[model samples]
Target: MDDIRLLPATGLEGLIAQLRSRGYRVMGPTLRDDAIVTGEIRSASDLPQGVGDEQDPARYRLRKRDDGAYFGFAAPAQSSKPVFFPAEEVIWRGRRDTAVTPDSAASASTPDNAGNPTTAPASSPHDPGFTVERDQLDAPPIALLGVRSCDLRAVQIHDKVLAGRTYIDAHYVTRREATFVVAVACSDPAATCFCASMGTGPRPAATDPATGEPSYDLLLTEIAPSDPDRHHFVLEIGTEAGRDVAHAIDTAPAEFDDQHEALAVTAHAASQQTRRITAATVRDDLRASAESSRWEDVASRCLSCTNCTLVCPTCFCTTVEDVSDLTGATAERHRVWDSCFSEDFTYIHGGPTRESVKARYRQWITHKLSSWEDQFGMLGCVGCGRCIAWCPAGIDITEEAAALGRMRAGGVLPTGDHVPTGDHVTVTS
Candidate 1:
């Protein structure tokens, strides 16, 4: 680990100014219409300070925290995924045109006007009847502030799926490669969080923290209460770029001692309170429960609205379409984000294979907890709990998984020869 730097809390504004001067656009969380949103920010004042949010299925609202801590909150209702994989983008364009040409043999036999035989009248290829073009967008370099630890881990997971092997997403790579991440440790956790069990949460720890394997360029640990008079920020530079950014900011020297270490320990412990499952048996347990009937039980109340996938930090499935104007003179192909829970997601030549609601629900859970490892060498879920919190029916994934875990332990099947767990279970239509 490189030597830490202490920056005056107000120096964050100067940092943003420096980045902007270098032609980078800064993006951070800010209070917008009673909710925290991520967008272009020019200075520290544009950030959400001392504001928190309350999130539930189909409901999200901002709240004021008494401490006035800038980043004292859990993950927001939105994730930064859309900034890379936009909802819609043009992939290709084509045009329709008609032209006349003489036969090759006839043209060869013809002579120039000066000789004898006049050449066939030529046509301008550039003067096409129709044409289509893509809109060029110059994506400026971005610096993300106040990113949670779990979401930072989720970004790595997405990188594996999108650019890990032969399949490389050009769109994702363009944005990801140019962006800089500034991660902040989670000081507050929500009730549905289980990042601890997934081994990706609480505090941002590299997959191999002891080996000094760093995952972020900059890591900020909120050391103490914010004081307008004498504000302090403990900054850790994980990479060369991070050190440059820190050096550019005009701030005080950071003291690294036993006190700062103790503060980090306290923050980690506070994060663990919301976690129910421990690291043990999370992957294997969820995999073994794939064939169990608990899926059908959970699917009963599922509306298949796909809100969970949209708000999740790591979900990246998409679909493409070719469209043309009414005149059919020009056409364009576009790609857009998609969800597995939607009916059109599973459509095939014959029909949708996972037609039943129960099957759709089963596929989603099994994919996230079971098959994701086989595909990406990591668990699909970071346990941000967006899926649980955004389910309109209040279907809790952690609760459902817990019920399955109990069934697996007792050697009973959830669907056959077992009783339902609670009143939340409803009969399927």
Candidate 2:
């Protein structure tokens, strides 16, 4: 059964040490280049202590907190996407080698430039034989520390899309299965955050029933100082592995008051959030908004720089590139993250199908909110607010969805003069 324990601030080091002792490469939030980013953590001191973040549309800044909490921020600049779904990875390697039979090698010999007879090599590029080999993934087991609720849910969404599907990504499956998650409750939800409305969090849940796996091995909830000795963390054991680590760390059974305070912290965060998204009808509304003029208005400001998709934990579009050596003897294939905002993403025989920026934007949002559910049984966005804070143009998905709702309520429709035809517009919902 799951159990709760209280750990003093000093016990944080022991938690990390336990994970390390178990041969897990622990990664956590660290201050890097003015941002709290996820990176390798050797000790508890590497965490961003006393540092918090202020985030709004197109704005993100770090600030010092008086609480002296290690995980007082809402969300980091980057999520755990790069850990499981890396930006770039080699998928396979190919080589064109010269083929020589055993008899040919034994009886036939080629003359060297010095006129000396030399037995033909077994393999050379000139022989017109090609072979491709899949690259073996060699990654250490990982333990994620201080992951927020929205991002943890985002990882679950990726698991459904990438690993739990008819066609599986072996690389993603391998890393995800070998990972241990340490989730921290959000006590500092940013202005851009709307995860509460999405039913994702402010409070964190330990298990995902869909996947039959514990969402986090250990869950942390930081309680503010009620007294000199009262400042401590409420740690919840979600799995057997978490129980093992808990035994190694210095912890006591959580007092009734300690657990109450932990719940209050997440409750306050939920209450502080003013942003909400009514996403129930958004899918159908977006499908009908194909002819909506709001796409043009938003496209005018969108730079299509793809920052939103890059920071998004659930955006899993990818593109592959093939490279060959100068002599064409060796070739390699790499898979890299891609974005739907790119005009070439929907390219057909005659140039790009979505030639206009407006069409590309519509396609991205439509697929993210509408088609994604149909394809994967869940919405693509987890309401992490990364797209809003990182977008240079400050386009807010919630605001855009509200705009569509208002238009639908007013019975407003776009004029037919701008009706798009040919391959210039995206017709797919």
List the global CA lDDT of all models. 0.70, 0.83
- Per-candidate clash tally: 1, 1
lDDT of 2 by residue, 208-300 (tens): 746767888889998763333667789988888888888788988877777888899999998878776777988887877888877877887
Worst 10 residues of 2 by lDDT: 420-429
The residue-by-residue lDDT of candidate 1 on 250-295, one tens digit each, is 8555565723763574367455555454335556777787667777
Give the TM-score comparing model 1 with the true structure, all chains together: 0.84
What ranges in model 1 sit over 4 Å off? 56-59, 98-137, 206-213, 226-230, 258-272, 414-418, 421-429
| TM-score top scorer | 2
* Residue 151 displacement in candidate 1 (angstroms): 1.0
State which candidate has the highest lDDT: 2
